[model samples]
Target: MTNASDAAGDEKTKTANEKAMAGSETDTTSPASPTVRTEHEDDLDDAFKYLHDHSNAESTSIDLAALRRKIDWRIVPIMFVCYVLQFVDKVVINYAAVMGINKDLALTKNNFTNVGSAFFIAYLIAEVPTGESTSSHGANKVLTHILQDISSRNFHLESGWALTCLSGESVAQRPQEQPTITLFSPHYYTKSEQAPRFAIWYSGLGFGQIIGGLISFAFQHVTNKHFKSWQAMFVFVGIATSLVGMATFFILPDSPMKAKWLSEPEKAALLKYVSINQTGIQNKNFKMRQALEVLADPQLWLLTICTICISVSSGVITTYSATLIQSFGFTPKRTALLNMPSGLVSIAAALIVGFGVRKSESRWAWLVLCCIPGMIGGGLMSFMPASNRAGLLAGIYLVNAITGTLTVIYQWTMANVSGHTKRSVAAALIAGSFSIGNIIGPQTFQARDAPRYYPANIAVMSTQAGGAVVAIVLFGYYVWANNQKDKRQAVEEGLSSSAGNEKILWENLTDKENPNFRYVY
Candidate 1:
């Protein structure tokens, strides 16, 4: 009896949604190309009966856990490794700081810091084209090139081609494969299941940090006369990063409907399952209105602001963790070993929150939960005396826990936002804002504020606290907006409260444009 009533209620809600969408100019009613009624279309629908059944679940017999595991093996590794390479590419320089990069490169006061900042500035400039072009062209063709610059240290090659390939093999020569986060998430998992998987994949950041530390440490023992220790570190990590990028370029599936590994039924079922995401399989048509909507979106700006705050903390740590340890008067060798544990802290926090989001109902609360530790770590660093080395080191470890928050914000944006162009633009803007903060973060470690780097530590803590307040404000805004929508629906359409609760999936509506689109709190 209960199942029957539930089914009836769901049907009623779905009917109400269809009525509401028809009255409004929404994407579901947008014209699709008239089907040529070919045998190919017939084969697709026949093999799996859900190609056109966008809202219904047709195959519950397939074990979700087993299938998700399969998807994990195929999809997650390249995303993780490429991201790891991206971090290691940036992080090797931090290791270089302790390894005599300053003396070798003839780096003077603030020269090292400037080199660090230069990469992000280049990253900031590159993101606009990376986002726009990758969305228009396929992720395979353009992303491989743009992401190479991300992993390359070429931004500091102000000295021309000589400095570019100084390693006998240029780190810049590595394949630039920027995995499209927006494209992949919608294709593989439902919004509810995405956070944990993204968290696990994002755990790659911690792994990369650990790998980078080991690489740097091992190179320190290098007896080879041909290459300097830091130079060897770059060459090794760069080559390994390139191999992974090439593998990803060839292996990663572009869409659920087109994945080579999946049988036709499996492909159709996967496509049917993710269809409620409302993001079309792939759209080449870039809309200016959606691009403009990105600029106009207040929530997107809030998301961007939150990411900037978190990324600032990341930037400070990435560029300066080794430097800070060295400033404590530890030898360069020991400093490398001490830095390895921060990655472990980050991994623990990332997995905790990733799985936490999977189990919990609220995402905003989780964001604030992650921020509290960052705030505490910042306070410890700000107020504690420099002599309290153990206390300060503990605080540094605590601060790394916030590194996982970047993963959270990325997942939130993916789960909540829809419309292909709008999501693409939003992803680009968030990435850009993240780079902008990183660009700002290292500059906080001015040469004048050397040794303790108190100013940078203070920035990490304060920005985290401010971000928490902004998250609550955004949460309130979502709740208030949801209420306003409900009242309007009642007044305008005489919709009952239950009917007003209906939401339109698979229509690709932006949160602002669709009354049925509810914000994730």
Candidate 2:
């Protein structure tokens, strides 16, 4: 009788609080709750229901700013290290070239070209399978576990094996989708908010480049008889990367659904917050039909083609940057130091253009921005005499700025693409195109064009210009397509007006299936 009497009194008081907070969407229905769970929150996965179900006095008082800080501290270090290792591993060869890979490996005229080309070939072949695997398995799990396997193998192979696509296992893991190259976007960030957040880790590529150059320089100075400087660089980077990979797999957040750094309420809050993306947190079950739809999607093809076109210049820089510096009459060690600046150039461009366009939500404008430098650089390198070292070197650095656009392309892919299966294929296709361009990029610098390498320089200039034009055309197409959709939607809803209704943000709908979907340009 005493317990019943107290419960009745409490219920009456709770009703009053509910009535007081009725006007707020944030007010939860529970009497003690200050915030209400919207219909949207109810639709989330069971694992994340706690976000909207908080009933305590403290639930309403969560420090979102504090939560964001906590998330940043935990997430950034993992991604930064991952990106740094990838950049270091891939371009370590550029340093290796200067460290006498040609003489040490007895790489004759076509051998260097063949070696460079071969690595990408392996990379291209692996991308689609990795993509399919990732889309089927989920990026967070697959990307890490696979890297663990490869990094271990790489440690053994680095002693003698030429570095071949050491960075091929790329997928941005939609839960934390990468700007590119396994870019993790943190869907919690809106398109506008993504750049500043992502630029922090994406800038690691620059640091990695700098560190790799120093390591190469240091190794070259070692007086070893059995192992060349290049071999030492490989072994050291490989062991460190392998260990990092193992540690990261254990420590990094697998997904927001399972992030240990965040409390249950924080996880729920983060999930609810990012529901604007229209893409869900993560979906492990792969849909075959979405994969088929990717083949028919025009946007995927355009994105892939763009990657191919831009990567042509990437191939040139990746394979020949050291040789070009050597051509400038710099000693091998000096070449390593000179090459360090390119990483800095790449870093500046990534942060500037990545965050710059993200602020305006203007992807097309940024693509053009990135390409302009490449075009100018290519022209200077093509027309200038090889003996004009400063001018040619300036061109090398300028061309690296294009690396920023590659991240933009990745961001664009994550923004416009829908459907897990199709996105997986899209990642593979875009990455594959990167390989194709790289393949073409190195071939342009044929033995025939060796000393002057005018043809390769021309290729870089023309392709970048071509890529920019294509980007503009694609931009126009996106506008045209959006207008058509708006018109069609207004008609279907029996309204003369084109105002949009609420979209079903989750449900894993394909872009074609969802009429309410809008593309980010």
Q: Pick the candidate with the highest TM-score.
A: 2
- Give the TM-scores of the predictions, in the order they appear: 0.83, 0.84
Q: What is the C-alpha local distance difference test score of candidate 2?
A: 0.67
Which lDDT tens digits does candidate 1 get at residues 289-382?
8778888777788888888888788888888889988887798888888888888988988878877776663778888998998998888877
Model 1, TM vs. native: 0.83
* Total backbone collisions, model 2: 13
Candidate 2 matches the true fold with a TM-score of 0.84
Q: Compose the digit string of candidate 2's lDDT tens values, residues 1-521.
A: 11222222324223422332222224333544423235544443322333334433243355555665676667767777877886677677778788877777676777678667776776776665656566445555654664454444333323223333333332122112232234345444444445555565777778887898899889988878776677778778777777776777676654676677667666655554455555555555567898899888888888888888999999999888888888778999999999999999989988887667644667889988899999999998889876789998999899998878887787787777776666667767777788789888888877877776899999999999888988888798789878877788877863222112112444567777767666778
Scored by lDDT, the top model is 2
User: What is candidate 1's CA lDDT for residue 415?
Assistant: 71
Where's the lowest-lDDT run of ten residues in candidate 1?
1-10
Where in model 2 is the C-alpha error above 4 Å? Answer: 1-61, 136-138, 153-183, 494-503
